[model samples]
Target: MPPTATPESSFSETAVFGDPVAQQLLPLTNGRFAIQTVHGFAIYDEADLMTVAQSIPVEPPGWPNSTLSASAEHLVWRDKNGRLFVQRLADEATLDEAILLEVPGNPNGWDHPSFHLSPQGNFGWLFDGEAYSDEPPVVTLYRLQDGAELVQFRGGLPQFTSDEAFFVRDTAEGLLIYDTTRLTEPLYTVPRDEEISIWDIDLTADWLQITKYLRAEKRPFVELRDVATGELLHTHVMADDETRVTPSPDGQSLAVTFKQDDGADSPTVVAAGVRLYTVSGELRHEFLAPQISPVPIPSACAGVWTSRRSDPVYSLVSVDFAPDGRSLNVTYNDYVATPVTHLYATDSGEKLAEFTGHESLFVANGRSFISLSTDGLVQQWDTATPDATPQTIARYGTPITDLALSNNGELAALVNETGAELRRTADGELIQQYAGATAVTFDPDDQTIVLGFVDGRIQWRSLADDSLLSEMSDYAAPIRRLAYWPNQPEPTVLALAENDCRVTRWQLATGRQLEPLHTILTFDEYGDVIQMSIDDFTLSPTGNLLAGRSWFMYGFGVWDLSNDSNILTELEDQPLGVRDLAFSADGRLLATGEAWPLGGWVGPERGGLRLWQIDEDNVSLRWSTELDQFVGAVAFSNNSSLLAVGYSSGDVTLVNTHLEQFVGRLETVSGVTGLAFAADGRLLAATTRDGLTHIWQTGSP
Candidate 1:
């Protein structure tokens, strides 16, 4: 039997009290930009960063260049399927009728196709080609008013002049100039040596600036040529260390980045600084990279910059001029450290602003900016208010593997690539960080935490001073989950090893392992007996009952932990498999949630939420309900009055556990990863796949 798809729910929405992720930011006009998220993209005015001029509920292409292209009056973008769209930014009456055109090649291909809008917003161009291919790239020019193709040809790189009257293509033979009115042939060509590689080209009203590197001399130089006559105006040879050169929008000045060795034993060559130069080769200013420690040094040596034996060095990533060309943006990073972006005054050589932890920066204007971090967080900054917080326009959060909440609900623990982080639940402020931790859980008293590492080591640490209370290493695989045993006489915890697929109980005070519980078994395809492991488990509040789902068989079983006896094992009706389980506060009700199997393995049942009554010696299903998406997490209120089921569809459905009635639904922008109810049952915290955490106020729901 095939799985039945559930219909969407129509319940009154519950407001999210706390949301921690912001939309991503992309530069557009001089003082405007776009904010994108999983939902859609919205254009914002930078004056106050609040006015939304236009918004479209369409997902942008995966490639950054194809995401959005804006001119003074219009916006252009391509969808994943190579469909190009043009929208007017100002006129509300023309907003509904956006011009659309189907581009020829695969925009989502490995070649990374890009779209560019003309300065006047009257023309658009699309470039498509493979990076390593010998064939020339395909270029198509389109008239934006009606989505009409103006011309199509094979070109190297296209540069449009400011007036939009002419464009130039840098080809293997030379630079070919094309007139907007006459599309038949090039007006003239500026010949160049075959051995010289053109790094970048910028076209101005009267000058064509080309940055080229000579293969024989191992050097780079800039050439200024007359745009109309194809005659060389000036040739400026740069220093050998100067690797990259970028011309300002007006083509009057240039920004150059260089690298040098720092006299180390191994000859550590790093990007030393940036230099501002006139078109005629006169150096205007030089700004050097700051020498600083990547991490915090001792307090005693805080102000003493020379105390550290070795300072961090950075390699240049990119350099760009502001839209107005009065300032420059330089980005660099030590491969192993956080990247930094610095804005400097082009004329004075004075550092205007410095932003750390960003891989790239875009200047909308002299006062407005957008930055992208390595981890996918996009921020917008206003230079006028340097002391104020930057706006979080977008975030691509690191995936959270596991999550745990403190008993008092005041703190939340999460595990990711950087180990465990303790965050305050109220406002999501990071309180403490623990490195190399794989799993974490809080004690009943909420004063200490137990952490499991990848090396199978477990440690109990105090929350106040972060002192290690006890530790033990008894396993040989990564610790997957850590949970405290409820209603225990002494402090006890259960640690599950990922590869070992076995749970080990340990005494927190003595660092001793306790006796093993019941062994889980299943039958193979050939009907032979095989030992199985638990994928997920939950212990009842009284510590007398335990429920777990098998890793291989997809079945789940209930056992009496005190007597070490299996009470029941159910393998029916569960087509996919159980993902998570939770026991009610009174230990009388058990809830199980299921997730779809990996690798697109579909079954008759996509999985849902099931409520069961736990008797003295048996378990019986009280009620079950199917959801639109497979259940990802489940939690019961402290008073056992409500059950909150989080689904992969980013919807959380609350139900009256005793009445068996639907309550309300909460929504997020991504799939829910984990869910927990506060100790007082007044708040619910839900973690999502987007690395964001949302807190909802539970008001009688």
Candidate 2:
């Protein structure tokens, strides 16, 4: 019987919850700062840390310092295709249209290209070349107001003056200064000594600060020179371990991060703190904090060492002067402790305030806000009470690899490399955790939970008391998938290994192993028969049919589990790869999603979702729709009336099975990793790669 078409329904997003990976915190004008996240930039007022505006581009930019840059007025970035984007900041809109500029020449050979925004946001510069090439790198300067190239040159690193009147480029001979109005020739050249190599350069209105490494002494030093005359004013020789010299905005003082050497015969080097100094080499103050103990180092020389400091040694990640130069912001590495940002007086060295740098966002009940941060702390703020403090929920040292929701929506299973955990969905409370777990799933009754381990073992444990019910250890490879069969006499579980081409079945009730089922076989390019391994798999509702997607063969196949016979096989001859497949509830329809072979970011040439009609012995294509993004996941509704397709571009589409038309579409902040529908078909859930899980209501319009 043909499945009925799903009625027209209104899909509304309910809640989105997750922490975005924060890339960097950039200080802007007027005590304002911007947090560069994976999605885009979030500007906040530093006084109260309130969000002023959010600037998300049409296509999210790459990581900061690589392909993304921002100023107070504009944001510049590069897409995956090396096309530069310039967006203007606006007070009314969170997202603004950006002008896309396709860079000339093929960027395929470019290595580690980066973008830089001018201090005033009027210009953008792109640095592209081979990382270790002998030739000089290419630098292209663009006028931000319009996508126009002003000049293109070959230089190592380009630094723009604060006033934007002139810019300097580091070259083999010296620093070549150029007037912004005319780039025909260098205005002046600051010559360098043969033994000195520039590591970093900061240009200001009156002075130029350069960090240079002395080859003879094997030490680094900071040099302050006159910007107009190109004459060295003062030079400060840093300690053997000191680095990262950042000049103040006014170019009067400099902040240097240094490591302290323990006074032993074979001294251990540890990052002590930042040192504030004037350009004339006058020490202002030492901004020292508690340090984290360094890891034990293996050395040939041994000496008796006694510590004078009682606090653990911690490393300083970065030190930045405030826009006004009155205070300094110090950040510490978060490996040994919670990440903290400390503000200190420049002259007095008085500690002002400490912040976790975690932004507290209050989103509307049904509206979605996407964020990503590097920190592992997770907290939930009460939207009902505006001034209430947030409650800390859970802290994860490692990133979440996979997530699954129970049938009743009461429990959520999260998997990482080290273990799998079950948390209550109501308040995000941890219930149980299993170490060495790779994958996890729940039974239909929600009473028994099945877990797959990296050691090729499967455990079926009771959810009520967290007791082991059954265990199987037949395979020698890591288990990747664990699913329970429905409508079976015994509670049977199927397990797929990461390196095997067969699926092993185990009966949980009697703890007995069933016969393994092999996937389809196909002919290779050399005309030899080869067994295709499944990269993704799905089972029919009745457990009588199974579908497997072969990533290597760029095809998918269906097999009759009752007879262990391959019933249908389809292969694409192009460079398209089948990503996911799902079987309808009635076992009469199948849906498969495909995408380009090269990560799906290379222009949308080929990829989409296809629906196939499955008969007793034959399968026919019902309809196919081409998409602009890679399809990451697909699932069928409980009644097989609606098919939900998820894409790498964070788009989720609901399609009517019988009509072959789209019912609704939803967008997320990142690529969708998993998709599922509730048993009653009233709710749909989608998990994104950025650690966010979104839930939506499926109801009549």
Candidate 3:
């Protein structure tokens, strides 16, 4: 046995749960799984469970149709308007891979989209599903390399070869194979043995392996003929009553796993010894179903409690070779999808690891096999090259309701039923727990975390030891925002009152409480204080100026810190209440952004971000950039050169502050909850409403 290979000493993350209603395992590639939900498609990395590589929204352009197919790189969908969409996933800050093309057929009534793209991304095949059943199927081929539409012909079951593509179909004359690369040309026709059905046939690159189904003859027989000339190479007579032939793409090898009746009272799927043969019909190797099987295969989340029968029942789901031709992989499922996967040496037929309960076995270009268990455990086994013990990557539990990443990007706090857990983001290692925390934030130094509970209590814990540093009595309400001055010493914390008014200040070290502070207050004709809804407010980097909504003022403000004076500023002119605010690293530029309430959508023209220049004499509006969609979050890059704006459209727009222009945009699978710039300012992290934290790289300004 070889030691396991690891990219790190240990790594773990939570993957997002698929929509139980209409969840599907999208094609896996390079350790990434694209999950198709009812609303859209999401790509998840093996680690970092909810991390979305890219998400394709199914709304205006594409909806009311079915998901054609999806993989890590490509997503194909059809809309009601007879439009087929092909989206290429990307990390770039732009939507460059979205392609909307009108498919030339019935739009609304098709049962499925018959489209397939090769793994190498060089060619594509599509057939109109509606026309296929009603009339002759019209197949169209496209050259992916140049985006050129090839010839159209009538065929089914298209398979790609080395340099040519071929399709098989049943005709009056036996099974006919046509080279799609050359339209209107027939490659070969199988020689019939007394009019056998041509509907099911297997065509490899160099061999057309056709199994003759004779009802009188209990077991079917297969013939190997040249794919191009129809010349008979050899014949293989299956030993059992039933068999399935799986041929490799190269056409040089074939695997036949058999099932036969043992003349018992109850039939069992046993004696399924798989045989491997070369194109010349010589037996290369043989593998028997192992008798010493685990009670419940690892392929299933839970095992069935059926009492063991006297005779063991076994079956093979699939068999294929490793890309390098050194090893082979075989999946043995009892009856349903749960399977026990056996990896064996191709030349010697020696058993390796027996993986249980593995479904959706995907082999990547790296020679590593990725298995997803029914229990949602994602494991990556790199039998290709091993060095250490293999490890389980993640369990991919239900999506976290809320999440927060430390400003230093070192810790990610996930919300659960009990409370919140702070885990090391680097390796998903749990570091501390904040029980019953409703709101959380880290101090400027990132060493101490301040947690607010539902009962209005505030707690501080040291990150190094997970020890209680300080605990204070309840506030009027659960804390909303915890603001700290960048350069202030002895660390004073300002929190929004439970009712969303008045800022209460406290000392963290001694848990000493202080008097509440108010900047501006309005009075009615009765001389009573007026109440207002305050959504956002932020303290300046120097802890002097403030931009928020209070009782009388709702926009930008510079409060008198020493006396708590309610002096109004230019912000009094703005009518819309501020939704979010941020101060630049230099403290000279204050940015405020807001999104209008449109229920759940980031409706167009509903919100935008405004940049303000703060100076000693007066505060003036620099430029207000209009956002075409609903704003989700806004944050200024540390250098104040760029601002990251997240939207309800599941996209983040990067605007250059100095130029006041849209630089680029990044797409997400779900709406954003908050946006924060890493301390280094090179990376921007955005947390989605679905509890996924996406960290994006924004290069130098």
Which one is best on lDDT?
Answer: 1
List the candidates ranked by TM-score, beginning with the highest: 2, 1, 3
Alpha-carbon RMSD, each predicted model = 12.3, 12.4, 19.0
Q: Tens-digit lDDT track for model 1 on 161-268?
A: 777788898787788888878878888987778788877787777778788889998888888887777788878798978877777877778778888877788566
lDDT of 3 by residue, 237-257 (tens): 766543777676666677777
For candidate 2, the per-residue lDDT at 274 reads: 82
Using all chains and alpha carbons, the TM-scores for the candidates as numbered come to 0.56, 0.56, 0.45
- Model 1 alpha-carbon drift over 4 Å, by segment: 1-24, 46-48, 59-66, 72-96, 103-108, 111-114, 128-135, 162-165, 204-206, 262-267, 292-311, 358-701
Candidates 1 and 3 compared: the better one by lDDT is: 1
- RMSD of candidate 3 to the truth, in angstroms, is 19.0
Whole-model lDDT for model 3 versus the true structure? 0.58
TM-score of 1: 0.56
By the lDDT metric, which is better: model 2 or model 3? 2
Q: Report, for every candidate in turn, its global Cα lDDT versus the true structure.
A: 0.70, 0.67, 0.58
